[model samples]
Target: MRIEDKITTAFVLASGPFTDGSLWDAVSGRLGAAGAEVHAVTFSADPESHAGEVLRLIDSAAAPQVVLVGHDYGLHPLLAAARQRTGRVARIVHLDTAPPQDGDAPLALLPDPATQALLRDRPQALVPAPAPGEWARFGSTAGLTPEDLERLSALSEPCPGAVLTRPLRLTGALAAVPSSGILCTASGASIAGVQQLVSSGMPQFQALAEPSVGFFELATGHWPMLSCPEELTAALLLAAAGGGRRLTPAVTRPFHERPFVLDAAEAPRVRTGLVDLHLPAAEGPRPAVLLVHGGPLPRGLTPTPRDWPLYLGYARLLAGRGLVGAVLDHRLHGLSDYPTASEDLAEAVGLLRADPRVDPDRIALWFFSGAGLLLSPYLAAPAPWLRCVAATYPVLAPLPGWAGVDPAFDPAAALPMAGALPVVLTRAGLESPEIAATVAGFLDAADGCGAAVELVDAPHCRHGFDCSEPTEEARGAVRQAMEAVCAHLSGRVPIRD
Candidate 1:
């Protein structure tokens, strides 16, 4: 089938002043010739808001299926738009650009030190076109002809520094969307981080390397559209037609048929209070685990669909292992304080225990980050149904502003009452001093109380290992930690060092 037949509208988003609509003429022309409606957009200052603008453009086009093609900084807005409009985006094409992960800044992704310096100096302002010598160092690397270089330089506008520095916020919305990358292999070899992404088997680059997110290489430099337009166009068409190789399958699961609803009246402030249960296709009640996510809340943010890739992946993993996995979205800091979150968790436990498919006697709790604070009360009065508790890079101490929410927020304080409930704690070696101190204090208290606590140290990793692109060391540590948790739930506690 033709690419145009698959996508009704295609938006070609050009990178800031580095290139413009004219630079994409060759590529867009080819797409247009293939019978797809193409719209090329360029933004002025305050590029952070460009995503919204692109959304407006897509809405204005009113096409059922849309394809977004982004180059350089253009990829940022494209990602933002794709995240917000996941259902509408048919496919995404990254032209000689590294797909930005959550919390990545465009400036940080640049492999060139010179480019970094140029961006840092112009904070909250506009960066003028590069000088002739600088252009030769940066622009000419794209394998553009002298005349093409002159035209690009003439069309270059002042790029917003804010756009380079602002972090991209992702909510795993694009995980299901098919994406393709046209890598400029020649220029990528010279870029500092690109080589690592291409060679070092980095975890962050796993999404790009995955089979669902297909990639093609071009012999040209950074601007494949300018240096190798025909090949770039072909790559885009292939991606649109779903004809690219993928390394790994997208992380998704088809489990139980419907969502088990929670009473919002019970916890009114909770966001979409629902427990998504994933159960293995089996005959009897199975061992179950409640997956709790962490959040202190970002100030003034509205609630959206909960889409933590880590918990989702873990839920699927647990279900595949013949256990029922329950994911709960508790109240956040701003929506409701610690008390509400704890109440919601209690309610989730009740729901799980009441479910016919879950083995109430063999339930476990897995906590991440701030949600670990909620474990304090549970430890203070250990429940028989709760077989074990697992925490990953948790926040054991209470936040200053949230002291009133839970007076017994300190995990150390509850250690003496923990009794014989086995606890597994995964600590990141490079964690910040505050968190390290909290973990240390908790361990000391646990030891003093004779609580059965197991420590799994990820010495080389920082916090959020599951979310990060995994190095070999990080991958091994995560796997070991997961195995320990699974074993604990299965009535076999692995001997700890």
Candidate 2:
């Protein structure tokens, strides 16, 4: 790729934790060949100060402009230096990891929360470098060959404890620096995922959509220099020209703006702080259905699920058929919000049961999308008042980034405790392969349990088929599952189609 304007660049490479400038040997060689002045620096070994060496390198650079590249813990030092040298930095490139905020602790940004918690309790002054089995704990080592892993294990240094523990501090002005994020696709983040996060209105992820920012996906692992040095060098070249993928600033329309597959006349609804109650037409103490929407949904969506046709339509349909439809917002705002989300769901259930219009003894819980993990506990300890459980296109287990999540959320593991309880599951035949595997595992687990499992198939549909597909197959599947759930709540055998 031709450099725009052909301006000279001072390439400052900050290698990630546990390794020093040597980590950038291959990358620097390639960059130097391209006629760029490259200087790679090592982080401090001292526990109290980490990036002073990086600052010194930046201060001594003679080039007209600088492009800083950081990988893993290397980002910490690069970011720290960039804060002071904001004017000189032409563009900043983030490799694999998400960029940290002004006050974020690098340790907290580990691949998953569980690892973060474990490491916090056993803090080390100098964290050791990657070993064969230990590499995965830090990040994905997807493309590293056996020899590469050996070199990594042998050459990597110990990371200073202060680098991970200390909160990153910086002036807000750094946002103006043009930036590019190089996604190690094997590590689970991609440009498409970034767009989704941006659309969800998560302020932290929203920055990736800025006009000053762009992205590139490397079909490698967290350690790109070791896995594909040439490709990483190529990406860096393009990143210098601000030539990678730019995220669309526009918010993605929910479900491609698809209309609901099934709808019923709107019912009179009672709005509370956390929930909306759609009162059934049939009046007194009617059986109620509590719909639990799925996510890691960010807090700032303009037309949240409650306003979306999916939840609204489902609620009204339930109400028109003589069931009190209760749609509530839980606190599943981000990945770690699962614990709080469960609490909010429990409180919502209590609130629903306490309502005078709903039958306290007859209520069904329906889980959807990412909310499927919330189904475990109810499956584990079924209450007499909890009549039936239904899930649609559910995430039965932890998704990729959250694989280290608590096992208590495993629906398959909890099925044995369900005993004689009835379970209704509507599966999309065309569900994403990863999620489908989980649903399949849950079904396999159910086979040995006493729980009566009824699988409803939406053949030729997707994960959110109700909203995205809207075909007769989706409609029939939805209606079938709802009838089964409502029947169980009404203390009658559900007739299957």
Candidate 3:
């Protein structure tokens, strides 16, 4: 092959103990056929040091630009290596894998609930390989021959339990490197909604949603390397060539015809509070909606705009409908407790009301998931300017893990305070019991108080339906919920489809 026609050196990092790197042979072979030098790195028992080993291999080759490909658990080490040698890495490819954040563990990223439970209960030494039936659950075996299945099962090994439970420590270097994702659409479908991953307040999904990270989709199962190597290889080539499109289509509506203007400003006197404002182009003093995203897992992590793609999209949707949309980043879970969050929100409300572009009396509150906790107190004697509250799968009850920390965190307790303010509650039918129970109790209180409350059910959705999977049903639910919110704030009866 001519020098320029040759592809760059590619390193294929196979996922942990579920199977040997043999599945990657087809992909590697194809790359070699294309005149690319390919090297496949299998995981060692010590995942903690795997990244170092990969670096050593790259240094030995002295390749100027290396394409780092990670599948599933392999992404952990790949990310670590990329962070250390960002300049040498050409592109980071995540193949049917969840992107790792600064402090994430393999078990935490597992899509299968049962597997997570099993690993949680098992010994924290070396985790044994899954049984044959269990292995089959990872991906579809539709195209694999009997020999392929048997070979894969036999090649599987035990992974270190530490790798599954321990948090992956990473610097922000990977963000600077070009990254792409090859989503196994079938596997993604089997898991909870993708929007839920974001709405549930996971930092990893936030990283994946970066505009810099491009994505490609495959119709195969989780083990795309084994099920659809050709398609996966094609996507890798496109990604390596910097030509892949986003896996999730961009939200062009509302913003397409009437483009919205985005502006940023920090809250007055509050050092940590930053607000992103989206305004319609043809706006005067329009009714405004304050978008409050859910807090992080009660562990005290600060929330960034990356964590609120759904809300950001909604802000644009509101702008498309001629309303000013404001998204506020309140104090993080650990930095500020309930009191601080409420205070920050109040400050944000005041700022919006005072803005000349907003109609103070027509302002609305849109709370997402855990943010509902912050909304509870406001419900108890809402201000005249607070026209209505629209909550999407809010946590009305205290999280079990945080129950001991905040004794006064009951969302139901503050329900009686929602005197006459109209409330539009969007419930995810597939939400967990804790959230479902909170919604039930809150509704009962709202009914007794005779508050104007409207319940919109997203039967096939999960918690954070607004940001959950981008299935047709999920997207439809989000649109319907947002429409309902817009109507409620406008004093019109929400027309449900």
Clashing pairs counted in every model: 7, 2, 8
lDDT of each: 0.67, 0.78, 0.66
Score candidate 2 by lDDT.
0.78
User: What TM-score would candidate 2 get against the native?
Assistant: 0.78
Residue 118, model 3: lDDT of: 60
Candidate 3 structure lDDT: 0.66
lDDT (tens digit, per residue) of candidate 3 on 176-212: 8988877666553312244334444455355545666
Best model per TM-score: 2
Query: Which lDDT tens digits does candidate 1 get at residues 372-487?
Result: 88898889999888889999888787532121233456688998999999898989897755567778889989878899898888888766665553566666666676677778
Stretches of model 3 off by over 4 angstroms after superposition: 1-4, 121-123, 139-147, 189-212, 246-424, 427-497
Leading candidate by lDDT: 2
Minimal lDDT window, size 10, model 1? 260-269
Ranking by TM-score: 2, 3, 1
TM agreement with the true structure for every prediction: 0.47, 0.78, 0.55
